[model samples]
Target: MAPRTPLFRPNAYFATRSDVLFLGLTVFALYVVETLVLFYALMYLLLDQIRDAPPALESAMNEVFSTVAVFTVFIAVVALLVVAAIVHYGSGGTDTDGTFADAVSVAGWAYAPELVTMPLSYLAARREIATLTFDGSDPATLQRQFEAVQQSVGPASFVILLATVVWSVYILAAGTAGTHDVDVRKTILPALLVGFGSFLLGVT
Candidate 1:
């Protein structure tokens, strides 16, 4: 189905059970991209400290940390669900009150904008991760490296992040309004609130 508004109403073309579809898309974001990014970053950190550490130990560490990334997916799923529940309750007085299932569908379909945004985001982030280099083997050096990663936000990365947030805000508002059977204005606050949450999580 063609989108009603390619720039805003990203979920307009979606059918039912949108929550599951978003979850699947999130797997690629959280499981694949997020997992590999952190895994490589962690290994990069341990390179010096574990210089003499056994290969088995490193592999074990990798296995352990991979679970951490997986846990982030769980957290995000819960957060999105919570937002959907809010939408259900908040839209109660509308002409057509939203059902819980519809709220979840809204949440899921809201993520549709990521389909267009994620590729650019992934490339920008992957490039940074790829070019990242650190010779810090000592605690002081490692600390600096860690800080660098935390603070490293170039213009391109910043632009991508801004784009994601802006796009997500509108798409989420559109999704919530359509799914809840309400005016778009009524959903704006909810969308902005959830958009902020996703931004903090680095998802949007």
Candidate 2:
């Protein structure tokens, strides 16, 4: 049997049974954290809109919603992995000794890049939001504030977003190839498709 790969090494992270389990858990944990960060930021953004609500009540609601969002993200991740595994098998890509579990494990670990990207993206967003001055009385002022926030975030955030997408695709391809015992060339297309789909899901 091959030795386990280090968690930080995307190409070999899912190479062994223990490594697969570890990476899957790590990715899930990171997803939960990311979801929490996103929800917390969202709650801050919406706080002024819900200013009439009690502070404690609003905080509790945000916490509950964040928890639910984390579970939703977990389910989505699992569903995506299952669907990808089925498609790979149906396409006769399972000619190697790898099983459905192996494919799912690799797919889960492929999300590891988000561990870094999500936090950085959130920080960038927070910084952008801080620069905006909201005016509830004037619709035009509010629109300008929104545009200012976008302009502030556009250049740097776009570069970060592009880098994250490319890094994720590369890692997914490597993980798919390593875990499924398929040639890297054969995995690239599926990896790219799935990576883009995941990116859209995350952003939306």
Candidate 3:
């Protein structure tokens, strides 16, 4: 039988704190841009609906706001998972690997985080737009805005979730296979699930 490897072996050349932080910040910046684009597209769609005239701008805006709110909730939930991942890896994992680089590589598991969080940011922007449309002083406005943000964030979040599942498997397979000098095809699924689940649970 093949010798068993350590559970947490880290690569010597893996990322440092500087690298992880830099990469994280860079990722966040890109996420913000993606959200901005999605918001812009949503606004354009809403505008078209208004132009069509059967559904007044007011109604279209309301529906859009509501949708955005749901999306925000979805994003918040996913964000919790991501935060957990950061905390686990950042604090030094219990895994056999002592290097931060090993934990950092777990970032390959963060595909869902990226997919979900970007859209959440867009929904947040949409909520801001909704506020401008709605009465500022209305006692109910706060609640309405919150709801709209949640709805807007949810749908896109689902896509992110799905993508993460697929990508996580790929990263795990590739990373582990490379580490052990094994045929990658044999390890793909295990690697992917491990990578994906670890990130989601913040145990990388």
Q: Best candidate per TM-score, number?
A: 2
Clashes of 1: 0
Pairs with backbone N, CA or C atoms under 3 Å apart (clashes), candidate 1: none
Task: Specify the poorest-scoring 10-residue window by lDDT in model 1.
Answer: 13-22
lDDT per residue as tens, model 3, 159-196: 55555555544544443333333455544544454545
The lDDT of each candidate is 0.60, 0.62, 0.44
Q: How close to the true structure is residue 129 of candidate 2, measured as C-alpha lDDT?
A: 59
Off by over 4 Å in 1: 1-61, 93-95
Model 2 residue 9 distance off true place after TM-score fit, in angstroms: 4.3
- Candidate 3 — which residues are off by over 4 angstroms? 1-18, 49-92, 98-165, 168-204
TM-score for every candidate vs. truth? 0.68, 0.70, 0.37
Off by over 4 Å in 2: 1-9, 16-19, 45-71, 90-92, 136-153, 201-204
For candidate 1, write residues 1-204 as lDDT tens digits: 555442544446433223444453453354345445644664555454433344565566668677866776677578667877766666653455556666665565555556566567656665765666554345466558756766667567677776777786776666666666677778788778877876676632
If ranked by lDDT, best first, what sequence of candidates would result?
2, 1, 3
